[model samples]
Target: MPTQAHINMPAEPVRQTGMLRPALTVFVGLSIVTGLLYPGVVTGIARTLFPHQAAGSLIVQNGRTIGSELIGQPFSDPKYFWGRLSATAPMPYYGAASVGSNLGPANPALTDAAKARIDALRAADPDNQAPVPVDLVTASGSGLDPQISPAAARYQAARVARVRGLPVERVESLIAANTEAPALGVLGEPGVNVLKLNLALDAAK
Candidate 1:
């Protein structure tokens, strides 16, 4: 019943060999180059050239790890110098979840948050009449900034000194000592590292 031309055609055999070998070779070669060799070489170079930074720049005291010098911690206590307000939720200064409020100047949320910070600062030191630094009232973009503007540090010096029963001059001195200059002497504003200043206070005590 079938035509002779149709019946005469036979099924072509499935060819699996020729293409597979080269495909596997390419996959293995690329995997080795991208997954193993590249990471190993880069890690080796970083560890050799920058040992301390590669190890995370952690601060250890009395054989116990405190924290990293690179990340900020929440310090709401009046005695400790506070760092930038983090947008992280459930916890502040969570490096794993760095964020920003992303609120514009015209946003009511931003205004309210700034007011809250200002009120908190005022409540902490009612007697001192110095104007609150803008840095103190607003969160930095990263929300994990370890440093505050020198003015912000000076603004809180009085309350910290009072609460700790130390002279304000001493607290200011600690702030001055812990202050860091802009990177490469020109990249950013000079900032006072809050954690270092607070730790120096503890050491002084």
Candidate 2:
């Protein structure tokens, strides 16, 4: 038998095409164009088209900015129309911390919270026995909801009237004026924009 010697072949060196450099370039280009430029253009157009809304729909009083229509506010006094109960942490109407209570109907905590809100409402105006509006007792999906249900608005009418020393009928009229109907008559329930209504109240003075 002849002895055969095994010869090892040299391995080929892998080549680097430098494709990653171009891939990164494409990524940066697309990110700037699609993310930054597109958003800036759209926002500019929106502001130009809808000045009031694009500018935060803020309510101003006597040259001072009071609040925005996009956020709720706590109005515990009898003089003001109360907005929805807020689930914001640390304080009510905390826009920076907008969130719902996440309390299910079966949750005892939810029940107790709702009861507390109802008690407060009743204490503010004992004469009005109308059923409490759901919005009044429940925190909205967004803790910063800025509108109040029409029923809630009506619930607070008597208290507002008494505090402002105005006739109930007159206050009701104001509420009516501030009430916004469903969009195109089919989108959502009729609601009273609290910031606008409060601005109207200020203007009345």
Candidate 3:
């Protein structure tokens, strides 16, 4: 019988070691670039180019931070314009806990909620005969919308005017002045920033 030939085989440990080194190097490199460098660069650019937005678009008054233009504040007083209903909890317009009510259109809970809102509005301004705007009763998708439809704002104009003892025309004028046109003239319907409108109303007083 012929003598058997011997062959060498690479160990499994050696192959694994070869693969692990490059993978670790790649992971470290990518982590530094994406996790550190990329965010730093983007934040720097945002601070430089859009400082107000980068700073949360805060609105200051009397040397104090009152609110942010990007977020809605709860204004239940009849003298102020109301923004969209917030579903956030444990309070409305709670930015850190922003969320929707998640009730579908056909859900009975949603219908009941709408009915309650309508009843509240009717109770608040029993003399006003105009129909309540739907947006006034519905919580927005994000539940933190700081703006309301122009129609919604106008619907409450008479109530605000009566509550503040201001003329209806003056309140309507404020609404007109605060109303923002659609972006690029066609992208969105007109809306009024409730915070700004309420601030203007205060300033007017």
Better of 1 and 2 by TM-score: 2
Ranking by lDDT: 3, 1, 2
Q: Write the per-residue lDDT of candidate 3 for residues 63-138, one digit (tens) a residue.
A: 9999998889888788888778889999999998989999999999899988988887888789977988999889
- The local lDDT score (0 to 100) that residue 28 gets in candidate 1 is 100
Instruction: Identify the runs in model 3 with alpha carbons over 4 angstroms from their true place.
Output: 1-9
Q: What is the C-alpha lDDT of each candidate?
A: 0.86, 0.86, 0.91
lDDT of 1 at 155: 86
List TM-scores for all candidates, in order.
0.84, 0.87, 0.91
| Model 3 lDDT on a 0 to 1 scale | 0.91
Candidate 1 or 3, higher TM-score?
3
Which regions of candidate 2 fall more than 4 Å away from where they truly are?
1-18
Model 1: residue 48 alpha-carbon error in angstroms? 2.8
User: Candidate 3: lDDT of 140?
Assistant: 89
Candidate 1 deviant stretches above 4 angstroms: 1-27
Question: Each candidate's root-mean-square deviation in Å?
Answer: 3.4, 3.5, 2.0
